[model samples]
Every structure is written in structure tokens, then in C-alpha cells.
Target chain A: MLEAISDWLQSTWLSHAFISQGLWAWPMSESLHFMGLCLLVGSVGLIDLRMLGMARGISVAALHKLVPFGVGGYLVNVLTGSLFVIGDADQYIFNDAFRVKMLFMLIAGLNVLFFYSSAFQKTKLLGPDDSMPLNVKIMAGVSLTCWIVIISAGRLITFYRP
Target chain B: MEALFIWIETSPLSLWVRGESGWHMAFPIIIVFHALGMGFLVGVALAINGRVLGLAPQVPLGKLRQFLPVAMLALVVNVISGILLLIGYPTKALTNPVFYIKLLCIALALWNLRWFSYSVLTNPIYDHGVLPQKTRQLATASIVLWASAIIAGRLLAYTYNNMMSI
Candidate 1:
């Protein structure tokens, strides 16, 4: 089923442009991807660290404002990452590394949902001296680990390409 | 310079990284760390700079300094990984002007951070009040510098003329 979808997607005009005129496309997407990665890590990661008990003095609510930047970064990455998938469908669709990356991203997304639903309100009200709940700490750890894994797996994609 | 490149490239460490040995795994692992480090360094820097530029006004600038250590840790990771990468392909990086541009941008960004720390962060007024014009300027420059550094670093992969000497 996945192969069929990839085959269909590969035949599209968008995919053709990504492959034929991809000399500049790949690098441009890659650069933007890096930038977006930085943005996401900087804002979201920092807040996660804070929740994990680092930089406790900074108000969690204030740091929450930076989450939008991270969201923006995520948007940029999604667009570029899709272009990559559309451009060389086989390179990612069947690749183990890409699969792992997607898994990590899924885990991250679920973790975010859990955070907002379970811990966001309580955590945001935390004072400098307030102790973080174990669940929030766990969420932060999961977030950091997921992002690091995502990056490592993304890099490994080239090495493990099918 | 050619002789130097050959000497460095032929070194055991470099050979191992470039060769088809188990140690070849080190090359990509180090690159992975490099990317991770870049994300931490640039990401934290952007956060701090964003705050200074009035993105998160409620957060105290002084408190943000706590993350400096984390950023520094990332910088150290990058430097070590960067050196290893250069060792693996000295001819590739050293021969390219983009490499130097990337380094210069990193240097400037670090310098800008230092200036901001000394001038703005240390000032008690900036803790809760508005940031001064000069500090905002430094923050703006820092964002530009780090972005340029990232772009230049990314370009090095495509712009290099030589991959290895040996």
C-alpha cells in the first residue's frame, strides 16, 4: 500500500519538478530545514529544559510565548520535508530511518498532547521555588529525547537509504 | 598548503574517519552531534535574542542567563565535532572560503552575546524594564550573525572543491 502511494506521488508534476530542478531545491530546502530545526529546538527545547527544572527563575508562561516560534519552525520543516518526500518518494517512503524519524515525530506529537492536556495549566503557574510534578518532568525528558532522536535519525536517513 | 593537507588527511585519525572501517561510523555520528549542537546553540541564541527584541517581555533577561551554560555546552560540542569533521576532510573545509565565513559569523555571534551580557544583562534595569537601543541592536545583530553562520556552514557542503587530499 505504501509503495503504491509512493509510486503515485512520484508521478506527480510537483515530484517531477523536485527531481528535475532539484539542484537548487534540495540545498534550499536543507538550509531552511536547518534554520527551522534551530528555531524549534531553541524555543521548545528551552521551555522543556525549564520545565525539567533548569532556568527555573524564568516564568513558564513567558517562555510559552516562544512556543509560537517553534510552531513556525515546525511549519517550515513540514513543508520542506514533504517536498523531499514528494521529490524522491522511494528514498523516504521505504527507508527505515525515515520511518524511525516519523515514529519519533509521532511520539513527540503525542507527548505534546499529553503535556497540554495533563500538565500545561499547572506547570505554567509554577513559581521559581515551585517543584515540577513528576509527570511534567517526564514529559520534558521525553520531548528532549524525541527531538534528539529525530535529528539523529534524520541524519541517518542518507546512510540507510533504500 | 597542499603538503599540509596531505599530511593531515593521511593521519591515522583522519584515515579512519575517511576509510571504510568500523571507525567510519564515527564520521556520521560526529556529524549528527554537530547538527544537534548547532540546533542547541542557534536555537537558544535565537530564544534569548528574541526575548531581548521584545518577544517575551514578561521574562526577566537575567533569568534567561541560566540557559547560557546550556548554550555554551552546545558550543563546545559543536567545536569538538567541527574539529573532527575538519580532520576527516581538511581539504574540503579549509580550502573553502565559506568555512572561514562560517567561523567568522560564529565568532561575531559569540562576541555579540558577550557584549549583550556585559552591557544589558548585567544592568538591573533590563531585568524588568525596557531594553535600551544598543542592546536591541546587539540582539538584532546576533540573530543576523547566527543565521549567516548557519547558512555559510550549510553551503560548505556544496561549495567545497576538494573532499580529501589522500
Candidate 2:
């Protein structure tokens, strides 16, 4: 059954269209993906660092303004990313590099969710700069690590082009 | 410079970089570094720029400055590795219009970054503990430039015209 499904997917007209048109679309999507990543990293990093008390001088409320850009970045990533998968489904499905990259992406996404749902709630929007709790700091550290892993995993995918 | 590129291509490291290593081995390792480099430079830069724009309202403006060192370090790593990769296939990248676009994006990103540092981020406004309105403008521009640069870089693989140039 699995082989049959794979065979069907490989021969699907949708897949053929994407691959043929992807000559231009793929690059365009890739460009957008990178841009989105930049957005995610930039705003998210600032907020995370604030949790670590990096800028004791600035008001937390002001920093929160950047979160929207981070969200915007994620939106861009999702849109561009789906194109790549649709264009070359199998390249990611069975590829080890792609597998690892996906793993990192999951971890990063979960890390953000965890931060927002739990730590962020506790930390409040604009808490005192020097008073951030240790848990929040830990959360920030985890987010940073997850992002790093995601980036590395993404780069490795190219080299591991299966 | 051309001779240097030729010589580096002959180096053992370059040989390995260019060699077709078995999957799940050397190739993935290099790719990991490349991705990390991208995240470091583009990812971190964007994050920092967001802060300048007033994203993390709670964080002190001064604290956001610290990330610059990290971003700079990431850019340095990318340049070195990127050069090595270029040596591995000088003709492929040099001949590509997409590659030139990527480089131009990077140049613009860096140049804009410098402007961000001087005009907005490191300016006296942060020292005064005030979120001057001007910082917001700078932050917005930074986000745009950095994001565009990343897009350009990603498009390089798809847009190259040929494998050889000159």
C-alpha cells in the first residue's frame, strides 16, 4: 500500500506541474523562505534576550512591539515552505538531511509555543528588567538553542541532498 | 585572487568539500555549518533589528546592542565558509546572476546594518533611556533589508545562469 501511494504521488499531475514550473517558482519561494526566517529570528531573539535581562534599561512593553514582525516572519516561512514540499515532495520525505531539518523546525516551533503559553504568561508583558525569573531565562536559552539547531539542520540538508 | 582560488581548490579541505562523500556523512556536516552561518547572520541580525524597532518592549534598548557581536561573529564564519565553498566551485557561483544578486543583497544588508548601528541602535537615544520615534523607522528598515538579503541568498541556487563564467 505504501509503495502504491508513493507511486501515485510520484506520477501525480500536481507534482509534475510544480517540478516543471519550479524552475522559477522554487527559487522565488526559497527567497521568501529565507526572508521569513530572518523575521522570525530577529524579533524572537530580541524578546528572548529580554527575558534574560539583556537590556535592563529598556521597557519590556516597548520590546513587545517586535513580536508582530516575528509572527509575520513565520507566516512568510509557511507560505514559501509549502511550495518547496509541493514542488519536490519526495526530496524531503525520504531524505535524512530533510528529516533532521524538520526535526529542528519542530523543536523550534514547540519551543516558541512553550515560551508563549507558559513562561511568557508568567513573565508578563513589560516586566521589570532585572527581575526576570530564572525559568524565563531558561526558556530563552532553550529557544536560542533550538533556533541554532534549526539553522544548522537547514544548511545540512543541502549537503545531504538525497 | 584567481590563483588563490585555484590553489585553495587544490587544498585537502577543498578536495573533501568538493568530493562526493557518501550520504549521512561529510556533506551533511558542511551543510549544517552553512545553515548555522545563515541563521547566525541573517536570523540574529533580523532579531536584533526587531528589537531596535521596539519589538521586545520590556528589554532595555541597550541590551539589544549585545546581539551585534554575535551577529558579526556569524557573518565572519559565513564569509570564510562561503569563500571555501566558492573555491569548490568558482565557476558555478561566479557565472550565476542569482549569485550576484545574493552578494548584492548581502552587501546592502551589511551597509544598512551599519546605518542602523550609527543612526538608530547605538545612538544617544538608547543611552537616554528613551524610545525615540526615530528608532522605529530604523528598525523597520533593518527588518526589510535583512529579510530581503536572506531571500536573495536562498534564490542563488535556482537563478544561476551557467556552471562556468569568464
Candidate 3:
């Protein structure tokens, strides 16, 4: 079933565009991906450090504003990442490293959902003197680990290609 | 320089890194670590620069300094990994002008970090207030420098003319 989907996707026009563009497309996408990685990790990682009680002098609300840049970075990655997958579906769909990356991304997504639903309100109420709860700290730790692993695994994809 | 490149290329460590047998994984793993280090270093710099630019005015500049240690740690990782990479393929990088450009950008960015720390982060007014024009200008320059550094580093792969000893 996965192979079928991959085959169909590779046959699509998006894939043709990516292939036809040839040399420039891959490099451009890779460059953008790297930029997005920096932006996402920088902003979101700062927020994570704050939640983990590293920079308690900063108000949580103010640090929260940086999350939008992280989100913007994520969007850029998703768009470029999709183009990559569309361009060469077989390279990703059947690859173990890509599968692991997807798993990590899914877990990271769930962690975000949990953060907003359960912890964001409490975080918003926090003043400079207040410390984040243990649960929030755990979530922040998980987020940092996941992102680091995701990046590592993403790089490993080339090595682990089938 | 050619002799040095040849000597380094034939060294045991470099040979191991370039070897196509059991040690093949070493080079790619080093590259992966390089990317990870770049993410942390550049990312933290961006956050600090953003804060300096008043993106999060409520966060004290001094408090943001806490992230500096982590960024420094990442820089250390990058330096070590980068050296190993250069050892593995000295000719590829040393022969390329882009690599030196990357180094220059990194040096300037680090200098900008120190300058910001001394001039703006330590200032009490920037604790919970807007940064002065001069500090803001430094912050902007820091961002541009780091961005350029990343680009130059990425372009190294494409720009190199020699893959082994010159």
C-alpha cells in the first residue's frame, strides 16, 4: 500500500516540477530547510528553556511571543519537506530513517497539543517570581530532546537509504 | 599548504574517516553532529538577537544570557566536528574560499555576541525596557552575520574544487 502511494505521488506534476528544475531545486530547498531549522530551534528552544526554569527572570508571556517565529519556521520546513517527499517519494517512504523522523514528529506534535491544552493557561499566569510546574518542565525537556533527535534522524536519512 | 594537506589526508584519523569499509559511517555521523551543532548555535543566537531587537521586551536581557552557555556548548561541538571533517578532507575545504568566508562570518558573529553582552545585555535599562538604537543595530548585524555564516557553510559542499589532497 505504501509503495502504491509512493508510486502515485512520484508520478504527479509536483514531482515533475521538482525533477525538471533539476540542480537548483534541491539545493534551494535544502538551504531553506536549514534556515527554518535554525529559526524553529532558536525560538522554540528558548521558550522550552524558559519553561524548564532556566530564565526565570523573563515573563512567560513575553517569551511566548517568540513561538510565532518558531511556527513560521515550522511552516517553511513543512513546505520544503513536502516538496522533497513529492520529488522523490521512494527515497522517503521506504526509508527507515524517514519513518523514524515521522514518528518523532508525531510525538512532538502530540506534545505541543498537550502543552497548549494543559499547561499554556497556567504558564500565561506566571510572573517573574513564579516557577513552572514539574509537568511543564518535563514537557519542555521532551520537546528539546525530540527536536534534537529529529534533526539527527533527518540527517541520517541519507545514510540509511534503502 | 599542499604538503600539509597531503600529510593530513594520509594521517590515520583522516584515512579512517575516508575509508570505505567499516568506518564509512564515521564521516556522515560527524556531518550529522555538525548540523546539530549549527542548529543550536545559530538558533540560540537568533533568539538572543530577537530579544535584543525587542521581540520579547518583557524578557530581561540578562536573563537571556542564560542561553549563552548552551550556545557556547554547541559551538564547541561544531568546532571539534568541523576539525574532524577538515582532517578527513582537508583539500576540499582549505582549497575553497567559501570556507574562509564562513569562518569570517562566524568570527564576526561571535564578536557581535560579546559586544552585545557588554554594551546592551549588562545595561539595567534593557532589563525590562526597549533597547537603545545602537544596541538594536548590533542585534540586526548579529542576525545578518549568523545567517550569512550558515549560507557560506552550506555552500562549501558545492564550491569546493578539490575533494582530496591538492
Index of the highest-DockQ prediction: 1
lDDT of 2 by residue, A53-121 (tens): 665655445666677877887888877666566556666666776787688778777877887788665
Candidate 3, B1-166: lDDT as tens digits: 8999999988889877776546778987898899999998989889888988878667777777878888889999999999999898999998899999999999999999887767767777777777678878888998888878878887887778989873
lDDT per residue for candidate 1 within A1-162, as digits (tens), equals 999999998999999988788457788788889999999998999988988889967878888999999999999999999999998999999999999999999999999999999889888888865668898889999999999999999988888889
Lowest-sum lDDT 10-residue window in model 3 chain B:
B15-24
Per-prediction share of native contacts kept: 0.81, 0.81, 0.81
Candidate 2 whole-model C-alpha lDDT, 0 to 1:
0.66
Clash list (residue pairs), candidate 3: none
DockQ versus reference, model 2: 0.57
Candidates in descending lDDT order: 1, 3, 2
Report the first chain's TM-score for all candidates.
0.96, 0.83, 0.97
lDDT of 3: 0.87
Task: Give the residue spans of candidate 3 off by over 4 A.
Answer: B19-22
Task: Please give the distance, in angstroms, between residue B157's alpha carbon in candidate 3 and its true position after superposition.
Answer: 2.1
As a whole number from 0 to 100, the lDDT of residue B19 in candidate 1 is 52
